[model samples]
Target: MHVTAILSHADEGGFTAFNPETGTATQGETLDEALANLREAVELYLEEFPMATRAAPFVTSFDVAVHA
Candidate 1:
């Protein structure tokens, strides 16, 4: 499944996680590292959530636009 992750670092230096498909967002010290952690999170979510066989998991695709 394709998932979109947005990461931000807290003032104290920690990571946050969110799913674009679910319109959720989180934070991390670094985007790349946060994304990697989020990958594991999604898998764990799936394992915990459970679903029917042959049922495709939801895919989340996203784009980040910054206005300057």
Candidate 2:
């Protein structure tokens, strides 16, 4: 099954990866490592709890006005 992954830089200097599909999260020292970790986490989660639906997440952006 296809899934989405969100990656971000960690404060300590590494990278963090999260898969919203199965709520699996992982981290690594590099982008490639982060992605690999995320993949492994998601796969492990799916091995025990398979996906029942194929609904994709709805991601959007919004702006909020703020005064300095």
Candidate 3:
């Protein structure tokens, strides 16, 4: 099954990956590593709690004004 992965830089180092579908998160040294880790985590989570329906999550972004 296909899932969404959100990746960001960690405060300390490396990258942090999160799967919105399964609510799974993990960290890795690189983008590839982060994605791989997220995949494994999502797989394990699914094995325990399978999703009843598979729907692709709608992802989008918006700009927010920052006031000084």
Candidate 4:
């Protein structure tokens, strides 16, 4: 099954990955490791509760104005 992965750089170090489908999140020192961890987490989640069809998440950006 195809799933969306959102990866971001952690504040302290390394990378963080999150799967929207199952709301599974994980972190690793490298991009590859982060993705791998996310994949493993999603797999484990799916094994317990499988999904028939996961709707693709719409990703967009919004901005908020700040006043000084």
Collision count of model 2:
0
Model 2 C-alpha lDDT per residue in residues 1-68, reported as the tens digit of each score: 77888999999989999987788899999999999999998989999998886777777669999999
Q: Which digits, one per residue and each the tens of the lDDT, describe model 3 over residues 3-66? A: 8999999999999999988889999999999999999999999999998777777898899999
Model 2: pairs clashing at backbone N, Cα or C within 3 Å: none
Q: Give me the overall lDDT of model 4.
A: 0.92
Displacement of residue 32 (Cα, Å) in model 1 is: 2.0
List the global CA lDDT of all models: 0.65, 0.89, 0.93, 0.92
Each model's backbone clash number: 4, 0, 0, 0
Predicted structure 3: lDDT: 0.93
User: Residue 26 in model 2: shift from native, Å?
Assistant: 0.5
**Residues 1-68, model 1: lDDT tens digits:** 55556565666787777865444454557777677777776777777775344544556568999999
**How are the candidates ranked when ordered by TM-score, highest leading?**
3, 4, 2, 1
Model 3 scores worst on lDDT over the 10 consecutive residues at: 52-61
Which sections of candidate 3 miss by over 4 Å? none
Superposition TM-score, candidate 4 onto the true structure: 0.81
- Backbone clashes (count) for model 3: 0
- Residue runs of model 2 more than 4 Å from their true location after superposition: 53-63, 66-68
List model 4 lDDT by residue over 1-68, tens digit each. Answer: 77899999999899999998788999999999999999999999999999997566678779999999
**Positional deviation of residue 3's Cα in model 1 after best superposition, in angstroms:** 1.7
Candidate 3: which pairs clash?
none
